[model samples]
Target: MTERIVVVGAALLDGGRLLAARRSAPPELAGRWELPGGKVEKGEAPEAALVRELREELGVEAETVERVPGEWPLRSPYILQVWTARLRPGSPAARPLQDHDALRWLTPDDIWDVDWLDQDVPAVRETLTRFPTETR
Candidate 1:
């Protein structure tokens, strides 16, 4: 059996808004919305991996505020976990310069409107709950 790969997703919150990225590739996942993150490299700590992935994928320095609390199954041999994050002090706002084609900063009331990846919905919902009601 193939070893399962742990992929971390970031629910990057700035103020009361949550950042959602629109995927652009890997035919199956194309055009869907997701929390931005990448696979954890061998021997890399998950938090460190998450920060690195945010920099690579979003072009900003992020710090993990907390883990969002659960894991979800992706394709076979992959699992998705999410974290709460914020841009590091002095870091610019994130841009969609990588695997994503677009970006949206969703307020709490409208966060549900995006077409999120099915496997990520639960974690996304949990991430949404992390925000204050005024934002959500």
Candidate 2:
């Protein structure tokens, strides 16, 4: 089976907290936490997809700082392209859209508490370690 390419963004907020969204659709994986992003459309750049997905899923605009360099293939058949981003100026309220049910800000240790899609768990774990929380 061909792998699906999905784009996800790692958004950090005040106090070094990361943003995670809950999946609300596709019965099988409903309620699972994941990074905010969606499938990359045909011929679309992953970075562009990340920006679009954030705007569509969360009511905020973001710019990609860099691609989280690595691939985590999930058992669910998705090969995710993860990117790191910082929220844009202005406080925008985020409402669930598409397959998401809710959103939360989490620290590294708190990340594992949420139910995540099988393939996403590894990425989350790796990211938490790679991007340790910075004291501000």
Candidate 3:
């Protein structure tokens, strides 16, 4: 069996708005929306990986808030783990600096508006448990 790879995703929240990123590379996933994050490098803590990914992929400094409760499988040998995170004080607003071409801050009321990548659907649904549907 192939070794398992853990992909970390951030359910990045601010003022009751969640940040969603639109994929811009890899034609198969281009134009699809998903939480912004990347793989956890070997030997790196998942939280650290998440923070690094947010910086690399979104150009913002952030901190992990809490881990979402469950794990979801991606393609073979890969599994998804999500964490709730918030931008550090004074951090730049998120931007599509890398693999993403667009960024949207979606309030709970309209979070469903974006067309999310299929593998992200369930993990996002699980995030609803942490994010109240009503904006604060």
lDDT of each: 0.91, 0.74, 0.91
Candidate 1 segments whose C-alpha is farther than 4 A from its true place:
none
Weakest ten-residue segment in model 1 by summed lDDT? 127-136
| Candidate 2 local lDDT, 39-104, one digit each (tens) | 788888888888888888887788787666688775565677677787777848667877888888
* lDDT, candidate 1, 16-118, per-residue tens: 9989999999888889999999999999988999999999888899899999988999988999989999999999778888889999999887888999999
Predict model 1's lDDT versus the native: 0.91
RMSD of each: 1.2, 2.5, 1.3
Give the distance in Å from residue 18's predicted Cα in candidate 2 to where it truly belongs: 0.8
Error of model 1, residue 28, in angstroms:
1.8
C-alpha RMSD between model 1 and the true structure: 1.2
lDDT of candidate 3 vs native?
0.91
| TM-score of each candidate structure, all chains considered together | 0.95, 0.83, 0.95
What is the TM-score (0 to 1) of candidate 3?
Answer: 0.95
Candidate 3 lDDT tens digits, 11-94: 998888889999999899999999999998999999999999999998899999899988889988899999999999999989
- What TM-score, to 2 decimals, does candidate 2 have? 0.83
